[model samples]
Target: MIDLNKLRTFTVVADEGSITKAAARLYRTQPAISAQLKDVEEETELVLFERKNSKIYLTKEGTCLFEYARERIDEIDGVVACLRNNRQNLDGTIRLGVYFELTSSFVPEIVHAFKREHPRVRLDIIELDHDALEVGLLGNDIDLGLVTTLKKPSFFETQPFYSFQRHLVASREYLSTVSSTLTYENIFDLEVIASSNLLSDYKYWLKINQQNQLLKQVDNITKLITVKDAEALRSLIKKGAGIGFYDDFGGQSKSEDYAVVPVFPESKPITINIDVARRKTRTQNLLQDEFYDFLIEKSEAGLT
Candidate 1:
């Protein structure tokens, strides 16, 4: 059966003509948007798009589906609006800057639940890098920001979002080649995949844990494949594209086809912390304040 949510995503992608643009318009990540489009195509069992010159164009079947999707969307919009009007009247706009990796995390569900209560409220979710997300908060461009960083920022009024451990992850096929009990300089012999930020964070972990000698392993990564987002890194690892660093926030670490292990088993445990934040100087409005409290409540409830 076709999922209307995926179909709606198809219409947005069709209207925008670029997965990146569609992601931005819908406040989602490009990878998440691409995955949704793939699902839509699978459900319909037809290729709905073609790529050329780094852009997406509708196929003949896609064009037909787009027309039907638009009609369904038009009708759904009216029904949704009527339902919202009859729901709680709390109304205000809240702009959120979310870390790119967190786009595929549980944050969206939290936002959706908040929307269910304040149906009239407007939320603008922007996918941003950690640096840009922080800049958005400092500049007052976004009302709230979600980010993953090692040291918690002292300036922002913050609430706990998510905390996780990122470790070396690989396919069972790959791990079997190297000793699963890998340590220290053994990394020099293995092909590794990681983002630049992950490399830096790992280095910091090594230094603080007094394992300075192991720092060379991070630098000696001769066979390295770099990717931008956590999802891409995990996807590549699952396909035997070398080992990458990741947290099982999505709880797929025990994924049947793969193995997740400590990047450095001998080192002290290190954690990646994601936080929900607002500028200390930013004034609290009804919607923003309520959403902030809601996030705290979710954290306490372990809602993820």
Candidate 2:
């Protein structure tokens, strides 16, 4: 039977590129680490590394085994973590990433409730956009991510948290310049300000109204000013730079900031779903599991 300890030592040595460095990292003597690596090579019947000019280098087999060993060790560590966290009293920090929209509106209430319940649990929240959230999840920089999306992300195991309506917003001053009724034709007469990332979302919403073709017309006839992000777009709209969009749930509390007018009564508020997601590799983490449940309960109660 291959020893897990030996495999671990080999992996560390491969990562460090030398037994001396690996020994220091593992808090073991250099001789002990070297012996562990030798034992691993003997058991596996593979020459894992070659030494030249006082430096160690991984062979072809060593590179392949390194990947396998690292995965196995990570899996073992995850299992141990899950077991430890299953205790009656929850403790430990959870790094959470949230989009800007939810940061101000929904997160405060959720955090207050969660902290009240589990006072010992620590939460570190960072505001990030959709792309940054994905990167953070994959890099293990965040334990949980809250984001709004029209399409599902393949990399995460996500649970639906809440559904919010996307509202068309503009300053009352700007709207007064147009006809009393807000229509696609009249609205296009003024400039449109929105996040460039949401242009596709706008296109998708237009398709549902059979006004998908209006996309080209809006692009050609009106001046579309694309901003860097939602915050910037909201700022522009508030300053009466142009018309923009925001989630009704996220912005309703700040409705005084802008006027919400539907171009068409049948206009479906672009239903964007806010979802809580974690890496697919993450499993059985008690804190994450409990927090996820709490979010669901709160969402079901219409707290968000």
Candidate 3:
């Protein structure tokens, strides 16, 4: 194997055409430079430099080795520079776990803006339900998460980044079939369109209403349709399939199709709070840490 230090010494001497000049350029003694060159020739069993007068010249073999050595060193230098530049630029992948519903929430816009700012930082977005999102984060399968519930608070650090009011809403077409005044009793009887795996959250919201005495019984949605994702839920809601609860942010609750008329007017609309979360014990990563900071910064700056 050729010693890079010796090969580098040889390349410099060839470039300067003098051991004295190469030594000054490299900040080494002339004798030290000459010794490295001698080791290079012994390794290759070829005299690389032919001293003409006081200047060094590359022999035919020396010229070939010089070209090879110069190319290798330059290539390595370029690679090192590229890697260092990437580190400085905070370029890497962030494995982001998000609740399926929040995928349609403000996350898209936030992610879009983040990507625009960090062109080199890629995101591996995994859509999971509230439970799976936390599981992924705790298991270290995901670098970070946007979770609605922090089930195991001791294991994670969370910051509430976004909050929105969730209202029990249905399309004008669906509401036309029901009484104008919606009671907890009447609303549950109507056809229900459920988003994936959010029954626990919905139950908690119901519990809030119960605490306020705004609702009494939670029994039946005689007809039910469970959608795969927020997009699918939107499609179902758009077609007026059944009544479903949705956030006002970019959801059907604000659309002309959904009748915003006081569904559960007695109780306050359920406020859904989303938290940006990560394991307290997770490994340190520059890209993930930068993005975690970016998320918090952007959220605090009213980007959410």
Candidate 4:
């Protein structure tokens, strides 16, 4: 029978692409790692690596085995964790990926509260852009994602955590110079500001608005101002840069700094959906379920 330790060594070598590096990471000798890999290859009756010019590359069969090796390793880790620890205690790391704008206010509170409740559980919170969040979720790198809902993928199960209305905002000084009532036609009259990376929902709204003559595309606005974070966008508006749409949850709290007004032909502000997602095949632990329940309770309490 092929040894599990040998498979682990092979997997580590394959992941690092160097036996020396893998040995350093695993705290084993380079020759020991090499011997383990050779034994694994011999047991499986397959040559796993191609050595050329002092470099190693995985063969076709090696690639397939590597995937199986990783899955088995994960299974072994799960088993070891279950056997070694008190299952009743809330433990293990939960990785959460959230939007950049939430880092300052909402996310910190949620993480603090959760940590207080389950002190043993390690919470890994990552602030990522929308695209990166989606990619991380799909790749199983993150356990949960908090983001605005543009288009829901069929694979993800979603829950509406909160609603944030979008409002047109500008500096008080800039608004002072303009007329009190703003129309769709006059939208171009003001310095228009918008988020740099367009979400799918934003694109949909833009397409419909442009088609209906509600908004005119201002190509020159790109040169004047561009912001990736919602908070930065609000700061720019406060600095008298330009008028832009800002989410209520993120922007409403800073209303004193800028003049916020409703935009006309108001495309329904997209719902900011916070979803708890995982691989369909994976069963959620008690801690994960409890945290999900806590979030639901918090949402119902309107703490968001």
Candidate with the greatest lDDT versus the true structure: 3
Best by TM-score: 3
The better-scoring model by lDDT among 1 and 4 is 1
Per-candidate RMSD vs. true structure? 20.6, 17.8, 12.8, 19.8
lDDT of candidate 1 over 1-304, digit per residue (tens) = 8888889999999998988899999999999999999998888899999999989899999999999889988999999998656546878788888877667667678878888888888888888877888888888898988777524487688878778766655676766777867766576578777666357766866677787888866766678788777678778887777766666664657564345555565556457787889878876576788778878888787865
Clashes of 3: 0
Q: Is candidate 2 or candidate 3 better by TM-score?
A: 3
Compared with the true structure, what per-residue lDDT tens digits does model 4 show for residues 1-304?
Answer: 8888888889999999998899999999989888898899899999999998867999999999999989989998998898545534678888888776666657778888888777888988888877888777778888777766424477676565665655555666777777878665555667666655343333455555563444334443343455656678877776777677666775554655435544453555544556555445456677666776777777777765
lDDT of 3 at 200: 49
Q: Each candidate's lDDT (Cα)?
A: 0.78, 0.77, 0.78, 0.71
Q: List the residue pairs that clash in candidate 1.
A: none
Tell me the tens digit of each residue's lDDT in model 3 across 226-295.
Answer: 8867767866765778777766764546555434444555766788888899999977787888788888
Per-model TM-score, in order, reads 0.62, 0.59, 0.64, 0.58
Q: Clashes in each model (backbone N, CA, C under 3 Å)? A: 0, 0, 0, 0
Kindly indicate the candidate among 3 and 4 with the higher TM-score: 3
Off by over 4 Å in 1: 1-87, 150-154, 179-182, 208-210, 250-252, 255-269
lDDT of 2 by residue, 100-128 (tens): 55686678889998888888999998888
lDDT of 2 at 132: 83
